[model samples]
Target: MATETPTSGSADGYYDFHDHDDAAHLHALGYQSEFKRDMSPWANFSLGFTYLSPVVGVYTVFAFALATGGPPMIWAFVLAGLGQLMVALIFSEVVAQFPVAGGVYPWARRLWGRKYAWMTGWVYIIALLVTISSVVYGAGPFIASVFGFTPSVDTTIACALGLLVLATIINFMGTSVLAKAAIIGFTAELVGALVVGAWLLIAHREQSITVLFDTFGTEGDSGSYLPAFAAAALIGVYQYYGFEACGDVAEEVKDPGRLIPKAMRQTIYIGGAAATFVCLALVLSVTDIGAVVSGEVTDPVSAVLEEAFGTVGARAVLVIVLLSFLSCAMSLQAAASRLLYSYGRDDMIMGSSLLKKFSPTRHIPPYALVVSAIVPAIIVIGSRVSENAITKIISFATLGMYLGFQMVILAALRARLKGWVPSGKYTLGAWGLPVNIIALVYGVIAMVNMAWPRTPDAAWYDNWIVALSGVIVVAVGLVYMAIHPLHDRSTAPYDDAIPKK
Candidate 1:
């Protein structure tokens, strides 16, 4: 057992200023520090919040949801929000027990073993990288809208690549700058959600509250609203994710055992409410619902905003949405780079040494950051070659992330069944078992709902891309694991002094 140090500042007086308590906790987990602990509690919250950016998530999928299911699709946001809250509870428990960086990878490793951990990390890192591309590509149209330019394929690709490069530069500046930028993003998103949502609901409301229940007569020949409504639920399912980014940066957060768990729950609470509210406001504010559903007005959000606030006011809101997109990409890139660095630290990836190398002066992982930036840029460029590239990439990101999340939850639940008690300060006690089960159930349902083929009229690949892409990612991981099996390289036994109970 490792002895607990006194709660007072260290004899050298440095503990009062530096995060010596967090350092001791890391030592107890058998890890040596390579990153600076500069993230405050709010900064940690901001990381998860910005990654779950309501503006970005809602704006990206708004038109699709509206067109597919009309105003009734807002219910999907409510349902998915409740389901995701269950998952967030499970995540908070696990992260509290093992507040290590790389999020699901280390948590799964601690609960299960090395092989499972490798695959979990593999899926998660790929999801995050592809998420960066998805977010950047989603932002392209809005960028064009703000600048009063038509968004051609070439212009969209150029804008995405430029945003990626800028975000990469900010990430290279180190955690302090990254945390500050995240706080700015959180503020902008929160303000936009409240101010814009309230303005739309108050000044330009066209639809009644009853409209939320109506499917706008788009149930088609089937006459049942369930299918279209469920299909539209994809927007909410994808929006609720990105909260796990908090755990990915656990090593840099102060007193993460307590702070990170709180951050996760708060991220869900604030992000879910904001997204639901914005969706409700936008749905009610539509000047012409028939036009939106019929595709006569392609961009309902901009159209509604321009009708209520004029083109100048709509462009002003777009500026904030653009910032949300940029911040979201930055947060995703930061999480992906940290995950790479964590895998490299364990010699689990291809370029372990180089990827794990931290800059001495800047205190950032340069190579990992560079790779994170470059790969997403390449994916954006690939959009020029394949017409369906962005759609497929977004599907991969959503499915892959949910898969990784469930793997960790399942491992934790299995460990619990075997008497692996949570010994962290933030344990759920009697509530842990039930919450874990509900979270697992929710994850499986969401995964199936997302992967099920919805587009019958489209080509075969377009309809089945999510399922197909997921299988490919898993097969590749399995093949790599078979070729270069990981040996059981356990860390020093965890010291009990870190956990409160």
Candidate 2:
């Protein structure tokens, strides 16, 4: 068991050696996981894409839409999907080439350099941590629904923390446990979507197909169907997130690069289709958007389910919600641990050595898992969950992760475009340049839109909390960088898969 490396750096430790890093540091945290080859591609896809975080995505897109509008929010989720697609495809290209722990940060380093890459990593890790908070907090309503009682914030907090502890225990058990969790998570999530989706399609009698393009040829601020589409798309974007969790455990997978990339992409597309259908069902089933809106002020899904199917439907969705929340909680803790471990190994985190240390018996970062929950236990304390706040925080992190996502894609795209990096069997081919350009532009836009203050879009005080969490996290990372100063003394060598100039 490794303890974190001391935060103290020496003043007299500057030395130059002209040897390039072997770059094992790039992969050692088990990043670009090699163990994936052991599983079938479907398992790979399921594991990579399915998990607890996607639930967070659903909450993000749907709730955000609901808050902004009403059932019309379905259209907004669709737009969100389009926004995410640009990044997904581009991210696909980058991961195909440089499947490293730093992911986007490494890509940025290659595109820009180490300094810029470090900045992005700082943001990415913090974003991930914030996401952990949101996932746990958001799981509450569902937990309450399953048991036939409303859980107070205190009860909800305990449940979430307990969920994290159990997840951590399973995580400490190793890849096999993760695979099992993925299978269960996949079944629960997909099947849940199927039930909900089928209900919307078959059970939903209204042929509101016009809602799809309701205002394309017509117009008015009376809820332009276009914005609704955009809203639905964006919400879809939220649901499709955490697809990268599969790749984070690259070391445990057999054919890490190929399977992880394929899985990551597959999860996005499948999750997208499933999410859209579910959104449609919920919107269609609602008899009175205004009444449902007012009634669901606290728990929208519960409100809509009750409104739609009465006692039976509400109860059923409650059970599903419990399943979904558990799935997300497990997957989230796993992903966050890897991120923390990644940053620690690089000493970007203060106690890198300790946090990155793997359990000799478990082959997992037990300490990392413990710390992961400990950090968020605060949220479990007295606080108005502000599920929207949680969503924004996740979105906030998603943007940070996007920076890492964008940087790497830019590097791979530049290499492929310039013929700098050797073309691989999986290269993006002729579509590389054009597709990459589109993705980069979309990424920049997404980041800017996310960062822009949207008081009209969110609760003023809650938004302030979300923004504050991200800012403080990033600022601390910068301060850590200034104090630590990179040193060659302890860093493990990098591998040849990554280039060192």
Candidate 3:
């Protein structure tokens, strides 16, 4: 990485944050948000699209819809998938411009102002924690099912907390360390998803393609044709979420302005196509929904494999999934830590002085990683009280992530409309206006689907206990702000100069 360079005066130009951050800016007494750029553009892109991308996001709802919404689940997936493209385009626009660590927050900050940026940042932060809870909570049964080793809820919580701790350590080691592990873990997740998908496709070659593509039908507790189909598309939307991770880590890439946008476009196309193929393989492979959903079969992909292959064969696949998901949890925790580190530098948390303490030797935000682990550890404990509540909370919390995503699009739109930033190395330029409008429309629709309460049996309403946390966290942020007036010029949420953070 290059050394820090001071401010440059433009003889003829107006104001703008410098196009890049200096690595030496990271060396400070209590602040360390700077990241070393070492990732290849491909790794940068796939890491987001691969690991934390939710398979359950696709499966949980669509599975529920299978019975009633006979074949139209494909349509749901199709439309929702298209909706995601709107958000993805927005990100393509932003990362091409500001390529900073504070993705949605930065864009919102640059567009709306500091206060709004902080609110968006906090919402995204809590949302990330809630998703962490869901991912860990869901991973538990897979561990037990594959190993035939059972543990009480309390023990499961401990294991989950331990995993959180491990991830915290890995992430705190440094951006390079975290990024390297992500590459390996991402490769595993990609291979695992494909191998299982391919096996199912080959085994179920006899099923009619028309069963999936021919028509749409209502399955299970799904209400009406159009609404249920709308809800089902949501499943695919969830699975493909998180590819914007490429944008958040752009500051850590060698030539973020160029590479980030390239990765952004490729990640979506590659990840989207891969997921489409997997879903096709999966729906075709299923012989009976009744047998699959009968038990606590959380790892449905593995379950399908087991049905096709023998018990021993399926168990091996289950092991692969268990390991893969565990790594995903680790990767997500790392991202959460860095995001919190950025927030801390911006004085979003109390004792802002402490949270940004970077390790001199390791080049990491140790305190920020520690802070990131605390809420999640508590969440892991809370999960024991009610597994269903935890899962619902995570799902509901994901809406904040969706909100963050929308802001990124909003930022890109603002940049194009206002023409305030530098001419970015990459751009939507002319297409920016139309793309942002479509993205905003789709974002609103998806949020409503998530917000709309469904029947108690429907996945939307099924785990609602956890979903309310988004409101709770936002309310908490307000209360916290009231107590400690929000002023931290040293770590201004936006406004370049890299803050004093």
* Over 4 Å off, model 3: 1-34, 51-71, 150-159, 213-223, 290-300, 411-422, 456-468, 488-501
| lDDT score at residue 333, model 1, on the 0-100 scale | 90
Clash number by candidate, in order: 0, 55, 14
- Each candidate structure's TM-score, on Cα atoms with residue i matched to residue i, is 0.93, 0.80, 0.84
Q: What's model 3's lDDT at 60?
A: 38
**Local distance difference test, per candidate?**
0.82, 0.57, 0.61
lDDT of 1 by residue, 401-472 (tens): 999999988888887887666655566777878888988998899889888998899889778889988998
User: At residue 289, what lDDT does model 1 achieve?
Assistant: 86
Best by TM-score: 1
Off by over 4 Å in 1: 1-20, 388-390, 486-501
Candidates by TM-score, descending order: 1, 3, 2
Predicted candidate 3 versus true structure: per-residue lDDT over 93-183, tens digit per residue = 5555455575676666655566667777778877777767666666665566666767568667766676666667667677777677777
